[model samples]
Target: MIAATRELPAAGYAPEVDGRLKAEFTTRLRQAGGEELKRRFPMLRIRIYDAQTHAREEI
Candidate 1:
């Protein structure tokens, strides 16, 4: 995923690459579950301000 993000500087996409990354990220997050995530990637943080309002959390 970092590789694709890095590619942003070398090229362009009309629809945007962020959406693609977001989907893959969200899927992986769902697969990881809450406890596994907290234990495996402790340093990382994710706070969704729209936990209620938004249809989906914004990571």
Candidate 2:
């Protein structure tokens, strides 16, 4: 499992907005250059965090 944290500015303090951004980032990570890593580590797990809300999500 890989744990990561991203600090959001004031604009992303809202849960809805931050959630959307996090989702987008996660999508991009999976689509952009993550294929090779996934292929090699099929059981890989990613945990994302939002510093603003201290929200945590696993993808």
Candidate 3:
């Protein structure tokens, strides 16, 4: 399961604020979930980059 952290810039020195990695993670989990259906569904990140982009465009 994925756990939320209060720290910034994890071991990879990646940006902790932006949700790029989170989105990528969710994308991958969706694939894994497709394969493993019997067990509990894994926790995945849900970053809304598309919505943010549309919001900016509207503004």
Top of the candidates by TM-score:
2
All candidates: TM-score: 0.27, 0.32, 0.16
Candidate 3: where is the Cα deviation over 4 Å?
1-18, 21-41, 51-59
Q: Using lDDT, rank the candidates from best to worst.
A: 2, 1, 3
Give the alpha carbon lDDT tens digit for every residue of 1-59 in model 3.
98665433222222112333332221223234432532343353322222222221100
* Backbone Cα, N, C clashes tallied per candidate: 0, 0, 0
Better of 1 and 2 by lDDT: 2
- Rank order by TM-score, top first? 2, 1, 3
**Local distance difference test scores for all models:** 0.32, 0.43, 0.28
- 1-59 per-residue lDDT for model 2 (tens digits): 97575445342222222233333232224334344545676676544444456664554
Output the TM-score of candidate 3: 0.16
Mind sharing the TM-score for model 2? 0.32
lDDT for each residue of candidate 1 in 1-59, tens digit (9 for 90 to 100): 35544222222211112233222222224424533544676665533222223323333
Q: After superposition, how far is residue 35 of candidate 1 from its true place, in Å?
A: 3.0
Better of 2 and 3 by TM-score: 2
